[model samples]
Target: MTGKIVVITGAGGGLGRALSRRLASDGDTVVMLGRTLSKLEEVATGIGERAVPIACEITSPDSVRAAFAQIAETFGQIDALINNAGLFQPSTLLEASDELITDAVMTNLAGTAFCARAAIPLLKRGGHIINVTSESVAIPLPFLTIYQASKAGVENFTQMLNLELYDRGIRVSTVRAGTMVGEGMSAKIEPETMMRMFADAGKRGIDMMARGASSYESTVDAFRLILNSPADLYVPSVAFHGLPAGWTDAG
Candidate 1:
């Protein structure tokens, strides 16, 4: 595991960037894939020779195929595929535009599947596929219906894929992540819409806007642990959440 070649989608920012850095620091070669070449390059430059930046629009199959091909040619084989690229557009169902809905499904569900399929042939036996999902799929945050639904589909897909790939010596697993903040974290909602969503979440006693979130850097350890698991041990899924800073059970 020390010198493994790992490919991560959305590696330009947020958790992907953090994971890429952490993995490389741990002695693995990291392929950073994202829609923006500049962004990916920025990260790769920081990681030096261990990092490979590739421009990839995960929502497009052709783009994904080409990026993976580049990865295959450069590295010859990959030890892991981290489906970490996603788009989170918050909007009420009534206010949601066609593009928002389409992007969410395409990027979160379709893109993940496409990457997994493309990586299948290149994956060595004992290779792992890690799919990142959201805690909101079960927590029911306001104005995230489409996002939640799409990720729910991914969770189910991960389960079925685990079974399907068992015979091939591949392992599929879900990392049901909680709220996380990092340098790449961003929100593009209009102020009015954001206010409405906050109000609605407050009405339900969730008050998500004020909730504490884990840092993206803090979550990288999970991926490291999963990738280094013993050969006989198979982790089907890992679910984690953030608590208020300094929070304790005694409180």
Candidate 2:
């Protein structure tokens, strides 16, 4: 679908930035949404005319509604809405701060729901809503209780949402995702927190620190493939996984 309007949250950096560039190259008009206008502008500048940058705090319903209204006026139609904005602050349930936990739920879970709801009226028939969720739901991890819990909710929401939106020709799907490598992976958590998690993992016979993240290109490619698939074919979801780049039994 050349020239399709694709709205992506968190398009300022990481995999979101990469996807914006990738989809734009394929003739899609990419609306880049992020909390910081400066960061969104930087990304839009790189993509030239094919991209539009708008400041939006996904955690706020009012911000999301206004952003989507602007998007509807600009494009008149939306082909896809990618919910990629996420907050990952790793900490055990006992050790995590209350604010961190609230932020995680609001940004990862509520934010996604807000975007999807706002985009519904603007969505063209046969539009797609894709949620980016963590692979930890399938492969359990420790010290990321809040992060995993929120993403798991997103995954569940995607499935149920599919049933509701099916009659409207709007498909809801998700990507069970793994960590991205280098610049594609943005860690909002502190180094000390990470160190503590690693230490705890080591004590439990797990070596999370040694595990490498997936490359940005591969992760983007997975998404691209899913989007490019024939509409006549039915695909519930895509598992865009990064194999344990350094997963070892040395522990």
Clashes of 2: 0
Instruction: Return the lDDT, model 1, position 100.
Output: 93
State, as a TM-score between 0 and 1, how close model 2 is to the true structure. Answer: 0.92
lDDT of 1 by residue, 1-251 (tens): 34999999989989999999999998999999999999999989999889999999998999999999999898788999999999988888898899999999999999999999999999999999999999988887899999999999999999999999999899998999998887887547788878888888888898765577889999998888899997788988888887786676545
TM-score of each: 0.95, 0.92
| Weakest 10 consecutive residues of candidate 1 by summed lDDT | 242-251
Best by lDDT: 1
Extract clashing residue pairs from model 2: none
* lDDT for model 1: 0.91
lDDT of 2 at 200: 76
Total clashing pairs for each candidate: 0, 0
Poorest lDDT segment (10 consecutive residues) of candidate 2: 241-250
